[model samples]
Target: MWVQRVIELTGWEPLGVSVDWAVVEGELGVPLPADYKELYEAFGGGVFSDSVYFLGRDEGVSFDFLAQWRVGLSVDQDGKFGDVSAVDPYAIYAPGGKGLVEWTPPNGPTSTSG
Candidate 1:
């Protein structure tokens, strides 16, 4: 499975965290992909290889998916992107709206290996 591959590649152990997908989907106003749900359930949230960061259901934590989405929506709504007039405006994704949504931090990923 892809999750197993991820574990092999990143050497990350599965935490087997349980999540209420119905609640999460209700809040997000969208159904998450099955693979993504699987991944989150397995690993929770953490940095992988000090690079990829998985957003999980841990509320109030930095890697909390819903919290990050709210922050992204706020930024989009408040016109926080400075001096980017050329970029086309887009709405944050909602129940029936199609638009941009943040799946990770803007800083991209980093590597811990030196």
Candidate 2:
């Protein structure tokens, strides 16, 4: 229902993201690449508030926007496998506060899109 509402309002659809196993494995027990870490830091890593997540309270700022948010993800479950972790992708939807009146989908590309 909420996902339908979002599509109605923004025309963008919720896409099941694809993850690279090798890369995820690299990050599972070890640190991610330096450039990637820097990017996450730019997104406010230590903070998990809505403001630190682009799809949450970040409104719709581009990756170029310093206020934009991103997560330094690692060892995530993939569609290729049945289960890898406790995090259920279906349980996680893009959260936004301030109601529908103040929501804007990213105009350039999907959050994981380039």
Candidate 3:
């Protein structure tokens, strides 16, 4: 609803392609929010107001956002501390970690771990 409102106001256009959730979730090891997938489906990827840059599933681009996120995970998992790890890197998601830790589902809410 809010996203649709923003789109209506800003004239943001969709990328016009269906997303592959299976591949995405399999690679990320998490289930994402439905609204986020809807937004991604409506708007492929790009920056907004020169402040927020949206990540898309475009694999051809060198600056793929999803690819970048994976890189961060790799760095953390490898324990190569560039200047202190921003994220645990080795931190496991809920059901494996401490308790119900919140996780960012790309552009969605921090889903409560079950």
Most accurate candidate by lDDT: 1
Residue-wise C-alpha lDDT for candidate 2, range 27-97, written one tens digit per residue: 34333344343333333223346465322122235432223312322244456853453243434334673
Model 1 residue runs over 4 Å out of place are: 8-11, 49-51, 78-114
Query: Candidate 3 versus the native: TM-score?
Result: 0.57
Could you arrange the candidates by TM-score from highest to lowest?
1, 3, 2
Q: Which ten residues in a row have the lowest lDDT in candidate 2?
A: 64-73
After superposition, the stretches of candidate 2 with alpha carbons farther than 4 Å from their true spots are: 18-50, 54-114
**Candidate 2 displacement at residue 68 in angstroms:** 16
Q: Which residue ranges in model 3 land beyond 4 Å of their true spot?
A: 49-51, 61-65, 79-114
Better of 2 and 3 by lDDT: 3
The estimated TM-scores of all candidates read 0.58, 0.19, 0.57
Which ten residues in a row are the worst by lDDT in model 3? 78-87
Among residues 3 or more apart in sequence or in different chains, the pairs in candidate 1 whose N, CA or C atoms overlap within 3 Å are none
Backbone collisions counted per model: 0, 0, 1
lDDT order of candidates, top first: 1, 3, 2
lDDT of 1 at 23: 82
Quantify how close model 2 is to the true structure by its C-alpha RMSD in Å: 16.0
